[model samples]
Target: MRTLTSSTTRRRLAPLLVTFSACAVLSGAMTPAAFADDARSHEWYLDAMQADSMWKVSSGQGVTVAVVDSGVDPSAPELQGQLVPGEDLNDGKAGETEDRTGHGTEMAALIAGTGAGGGIQGLAPRAKILPLRYNVKAPSMDTAPRGIRYAVDHGARIINMSFGIELPGEIPGLREAIDYADRKGVLMFASSGNAGDKDNVITAPASMAGVVAVGAVDKSLTVTKWSNHGSELALAAPGDDIPMRCANGEGYCSSGGTSQATALASASAALVWSAHPGWTGNQVLRALIETAGRPTEGKVPSEYVGYGFVRPRMVLLEHQGDPGAANVYPLPNGPASASSSPAPSKAGQAVSSAPQHGEAEAAAGSGNTTLWVLLGLGAAVVVGGVAAFVVRRRSA
Candidate 1:
């Protein structure tokens, strides 16, 4: 059993220093008083992704996403009525709402926060959260796998795993749990990892088959330097300088990581799933991949950005993308293809054995430049109600 740890990296903001009342912190009661007045202003991706327009179509009303992390603070203002009954895989003593590291609560808020009392506004504001707590430091590997099974057996349709382990091979129990979830029509998303500039090793369960491995990109749509990359990387999302509720129950903090990217990807799926309530997990994932922003110059499934940045607006607002066959899983190593090829079970094996497309980093840079130009053109069209073309002339 591999020990799981949070994939998020938080940076305290000196300028945004509003703390909850001492009494509230001591009494273990989360209050709205800790939220900063200008917190929402920093949620740049909401506007960039045109969440308001998407919200008009679906707020993920009926979907329940299981957040398997440290824990969740159900009392948080944004999560007041959003959580369902949850379990603590660590020990039955502290329930799922006791958020030890604050990471779980942050992830939950990102997926379904209602923005009450100036709190974070979730992408899928109406969705419900089922918090499943796993002890990060516990030596037992059973916690994560048990949590995954618990979510699948419960009413969860999507599971957001914002934590990861950089292991050389797959843990049988963990892999089996993920496979089980897939069989039950549950879509799983995990942070690829945050060691892009460092070790850059693939992490599990992200590299595992049947899971959507998410990487991070900035407001410019450029893949962040710290987001892990590999053949298993399935998608990218805005993850840089993201704002979230602080763990200390103080004001919000600005942070960035693949963890945030994974949450957004899961939330994006919820939005699509809620709109098309009858769609299977395969169909929903198909829609997401088919509509994702792709590179102009390189073959898709790029190691850096995968199918490209996740743009649910294309599915929700524009009515784009084909939700292909319900029974057929979309990506590699899907259930549809599981029996044919050996499962890419080991992180090291998955990373080393997969065929390398061109230089991933180089491809990503060129593709992002094209994507930015396209986004700029799209913005111009929205403003002017006419198609705009930008031709970049090369110097002779």
Candidate 2:
């Protein structure tokens, strides 16, 4: 998209009064609104994921993310109407909903931008983006598995996929459209590749196997030599140099990779699946990997950063968690089922005990650089030579 990012220390942004609703005001085709005053005052991970008490609870509304890539203009005024109509497995010539390369409109305005116009204010700020539009840059090999089966046949529960391929094999129609969007449950994130300090490559629908991958952290939780790590990652977000809105929202650019951390881990699973709308996408990925953000306690995960950086406010405001079962599969190794075989990983328990009810802006430990981050849903990376959807700039 457009990046240059920076972070060694010295940062602020957490005042957040946030009220919005004269139809979500503030836009003069934003970007550069005096640098920082509103429009999420340059989003420092939304006050380290408190975002005005998780938008009171969850502004993700009904939820409907399906941002394949290479398109999604949605008229840009912080994405008017938040958008709903999608499709363009790369056919409408090129303007598929229209976006060329603001990097899918900066991962769809960082997963539903609602800062109105100064831009960049989305961590599910009333989530709603469904612009499928493939043709990634060139190497389509079938418009990214027909835009992941047209975003799980039109409904789109969740499927971010910022973009990636690395080419080697496993393109069997994107592993049969990721086992048909995991038998239509959806959820699929991606990104887990920025090159992890160059050539630590792994890529594939984010190394396939149900897809979640992600990775990328900075601001101090470390792990950003270039993102991309192994054991198929599974967590981590915040891809440094943050700040977005380029692709025609006029100005404002300072993107990162892991494609804005897979659109903030798909807007933190559309705010814990819009506050548990009956929960299932394997219980909202087992309550965001059991309230993530671990560094140690017993069995943490890490090729770089996994199972530890996506705290959906400790499962939506200290209710803590346990969203297991529901066709189980909490991620741990992969590719091991030939038929209906999904019940084993009841997932972890000691999320260090999980209880931040006192929320002094949470994040009291575990690399507490404002509590790591989330949103690096794979894809959108290409070393060189590409074409049916070619790319290589998540802030290269």
Candidate 3:
């Protein structure tokens, strides 16, 4: 068996054991009292994304997002009554609510936390969380596939994978499981990786088709320097300078990375799905893509921010975005036919090089042109100009 290293920090593990490290990104400890006093203030993305306005329309009440990661602490104030019983693929003795690394808890909170007891408020406050635990330190190849299948079988509408493995190619059973989840109409989101400023190697499951590979953006709405970029990237969300529950459960901590971005994207999907319960996973994803914030200048699907930053507000509040054909997957590497099951292709590589029509038009100024056109109007003209400059600076 080949060994796998986490996309976050690279470390040696025992032979035959794969390491699926939690994409902790960047983290710093904070005391409980201090966190209670100032934690929510650090969540700048909530305000920037206009979460308050979106909440008035939908709180993701009926959606359940499965978090595949270290584990979640059900006892946390914000997570109370938010967790559905989940299975632990690791030892199975501790169950899924016990968090060893705290990363899972942070991701859970980011998706559905209720903001009680001064905790971090989730993007979809009323959504439920289903935690699926795997052995991060010494997992086998089957670990991720098992967790994914469990989430799909257990009524999880969306799956959030906040960890990644850097492999030269796809893992044996992982890709098939993702396709299975897709065929089942389950939407999956994974972190694009946090090594953007470094090696920036494409990390799997994220790069795999059928999974939405999410990158990171800061409070300025510009992609973060550490958020990995590639053809596989599908969307982006706020990740930098975010607040999260500390692993030790003492209080909160400031963290940043694509992992957080993935959580927010999942929550965004939950909100859209909750508002439109009859919408299929494909429709929900389509709405997100159609309403996403694209770069003012660049190819429609930029290697950095894929379709662009996720903006559920445009779909939820403004009633914008067209939910396209429910059965047809929207992305380039999506299933070939309308059957929902992915068309057969090479084992690991993505097949399609062309962008979707809507994506292309959106990029070419057919739709949403009024929203971002001002970005090209020069820095002194509009806020989007500043954003354009920042995006170019970081990507350069």
Quantify all predictions' global Cα lDDT against the true fold.
0.74, 0.64, 0.72
**Where does the lowest 10-residue lDDT sum fall in candidate 2?**
21-30
Model 3 C-alpha lDDT per residue in residues 284-382, reported as the tens digit of each score: 998887767655544666677777678788788768777877888877778432344331122122212232211221122344222221111112112
lDDT of 1: 0.74
Work out the TM-score per prediction.
0.82, 0.31, 0.81
Error of 3 at 221 (Å): 2.5
Count: clashes, candidate 3: 0
Please provide, for model 2 over 145-190, each residue's C-alpha lDDT reduced to its tens digit, 9 standing for 90 to 100: 8888888888889988876777666777778888888877888888
Residue 362 lDDT in candidate 1: 18
Q: TM-score-based ranking, best first?
A: 1, 3, 2
lDDT of 2 at 63: 83
Report residue 179 deviation for candidate 1 (angstroms): 1.4
Decoy 1 TM-score against native: 0.82
Residue 324 local lDDT, model 1: 65
TM-score of candidate 2 versus the correct structure, residues matched by position: 0.31
Clashes of each: 0, 28, 0
